[model samples]
Target: MDSGLGEGSSGYSTMDDYESLISTTDAELLKRAWRNEKAAPQILRYEAALVQRSREQIKLMEETVEEFTSSGVDPLTVSLYQMDLDRTLFLLRSYLRVRLQKIEKYMFHIRKTTELWNHLSRAEQNFAERCIEDMEQHMQQSVLSKLPSSYKSHLKQSSSSEEDDMVPEPKLDTYVICRSKKFLGAFQLDDRQFLSIQCHLLSWRMNSFIFLMSMNFWTVLKTLLTLKLMIYTLYLISL
Candidate 1:
């Protein structure tokens, strides 16, 4: 008699454990474990296709502008590629952000339902992680393109410019996220991480306005002081 089925069942405990293990890898199990709206393979494929087309268009624009004669991947053409890549990346990243937000909510429900930390099977987790990693890699490429050529890393897969790419490229910082429920503020756990909040950090227009206002105020103050000085000089001359 197995205790799993209350002393009367034979292999129920063993069967239960096996079922738990199988669910992680099984597509149906993954569907149940996944928090967000069921994302179809077709949707992911469609996103990939759009990204590919954007890349091709940029490459074509670059080639056409140069009549395909340029030996070097023109930096201008690279800019076009970087922009399209950035746009796609931004869209995908936003989607992931929304998903992550929802995950926190699903996590509580999943906790009550599943005994596992990683609810899905290892294979499924790996596949999802790979997709995330691909997005991160494209982001890295986008960052590198925007940076000065000298700042681009000499990766193992880099084409042809190993010699010029020699002068040690600058490294972007890694990110570490620390989830704190009590603090209620989302922030990087470590300063070592690169933050995507640069745009949100400060208002450029506000800073520019302050800079211009100060310049104008100083000019007016100087003009008023000069007029006062001239008036005093005339009085002194009259005396």
Candidate 2:
């Protein structure tokens, strides 16, 4: 499938061939995404249109990969789709990572805001701290939940590689999570006071951001999910 089952294979461009294989809507979505343009149904917000476009492309690509695999395409072809999807996912994940870093900064800001607020003499400080905690919790919840279910579940399933199938091994590192739990024990703040807010004001700003990223979050780059998607697509194609 990479070169092909053929006499004309030497003349073909892989990019062009694969482009044709893509669904027209997927192609349009991708084209617009790359162009970073605003277009129809306004399915994506103007600021996030490109990201949504890219995500739509991947979703459609996943569907196409499924169709190919199910049709009994050779492993080589499957490999191409896999690699293409992998690359796109890599980009998507990279974008998410960048956003996550921003979220991290904002989280720090939320803490810092209150930390500074805590330094104030009296009523103002308490009011600010309460606001900050409420904002932080809301921001965390919104970002965490907004990620696509299909993309998220797919990632969880595809955590390992085909190469790893060669050996039996413990799946996760024990220390990281354990250490995190320990860290949580050290921070003492009001839990309910942490939650309640009059308007959810500051957090709503963060919510807007999470809303934007949710439309474009890159869980697709996760190899495990990619593999699972491929296998599922293959099944669909076969049907």
Candidate 3:
């Protein structure tokens, strides 16, 4: 199987070099970003630079397609370019939509957690803030207004509650498939256990193991979803 790495390349290079070799196109980078976003249970750091470049490229492609149409380019050729543009647009939109869904599901948890809050882009932060406001208002008017003051706080179950136990959090203890370009032998999982990353395959079974995501695994990172995750990702794709 061709890994898309250069032909006859051997020995490990630096992570930067490896990533550069594989992600030679904006479309490839965007595809990887979309996969990583959809696979992870939690919201990831926004791919601001990649998003910007994709948008710019999409705009240029749109203009090029328009030019081709006006200049009487072959119908088949113009349609191909249009199809490529549509795919990129779909990826960008799908990536943003996934983040929105995660935000809506875990807005309270993400807002209170500084680390997660920092992962959102400014536009996403604004959207989350508005979502929180709307949710609080809806709850206040529809139900919380009739409840006792002790139970009115949305973040907590009751006045006596010591923490925001009502807030939903991401399930970190889930499996996600990660692929690595480099051949790794006996990759250590812990002091007592080890795993292999050969043939570009890995089944990482927790967000806690994300620390092992270094440069080699960074190249062409994509996920193979479990059954539950497959359904979830399919739902996102359908949107």
Candidate 4:
């Protein structure tokens, strides 16, 4: 059972480092399990391997504690090792238990059809059926018996209302006019209004230009009158 738990340098003296290693291994296994449901047997084998490893680790920790006691090591160091060992055992057991729980929950779906049941070995089929039976019994005794009548009724009412609620059709106002007769009429109206605005602007600009030209004409006339008066005055002075 190559659990894929890495046998790296066993020189990690701290609980944190050991936890990191275990967490990494557990994450990889979980990823694999999630990726393929058919790999349940492999997952179970890996879990068993981890359990074995945990047992070995606990034994080793015990021996280490014994050695430290005889060798005058600090009591705190021994207690730390014991704590780490206990934590490791707890995590390993929890990991295995969770996997088993998932297996039990999904056992029915895993072997729902005869074809699927036939594909499994006798032992696998038996194990799956056993899990199903156990789960069914547990649910009947613990979950179904504990459910309140009001909660069940509410659930039924909610489901019935959800089924009854038909999606309403969109209102006419929500529709956009793209290429209908109404759209063409609206576009023509808008075009006419835009043309009217343009005509008004052009008319105003032309009036302004005419007013400026008239002002220039008046200025030129006034200058010519002054020049003519100067010429007449010079003529009078010569006479």
Query: What would the TM-scores of all predictions be?
Result: 0.21, 0.29, 0.73, 0.32
Per-model lDDT: 0.33, 0.36, 0.68, 0.40
lDDT of 2 at 50: 48
Ranking by TM-score: 3, 4, 2, 1
Where is model 3 poorest over a 10-residue stretch in terms of lDDT? 230-239
Best by TM-score: 3
Q: Per-residue lDDT for 64-161 in model 1, tens only?
A: 54653455667887667666545544444454444443334333332233332253334334544554456447756877677665555534234445
- Tens-digit lDDT string for candidate 3 (1-239): 24433322343446536655766687877786787788767787898999999999899999999999999999999999999999999999999999999999999999998988999999999999999999999999999999999999988999999989899986553433444433332233322222223233333222212222222221212223211111122111110
Candidate 1 TM-score, true structure as reference: 0.21
lDDT of 4 by residue, 148-190 (tens): 6532321233334643222221111111111110100111112
As for lDDT, the candidate ahead, 1 or 2, is 2
Q: Which stretches of candidate 1 lie over 4 Å from their true place?
A: 1-71, 111-239
Best by lDDT: 3
Regions more than 4 Å wrong, model 2:
1-47, 107-239
Q: List the residue pairs that clash in candidate 1.
A: 24-121, 174-193
Evaluated against the true structure, the overall lDDT of model 2 is: 0.36
Ranking by lDDT: 3, 4, 2, 1
Where is model 4 poorest over a 10-residue stretch in terms of lDDT? 230-239
Question: Taking the tens digit of each residue's C-alpha lDDT, what string does model 2 give over 24-130?
Answer: 44333343232221111111112255456767877878998999889988989888988878767766555444333333333333234444224233433354456
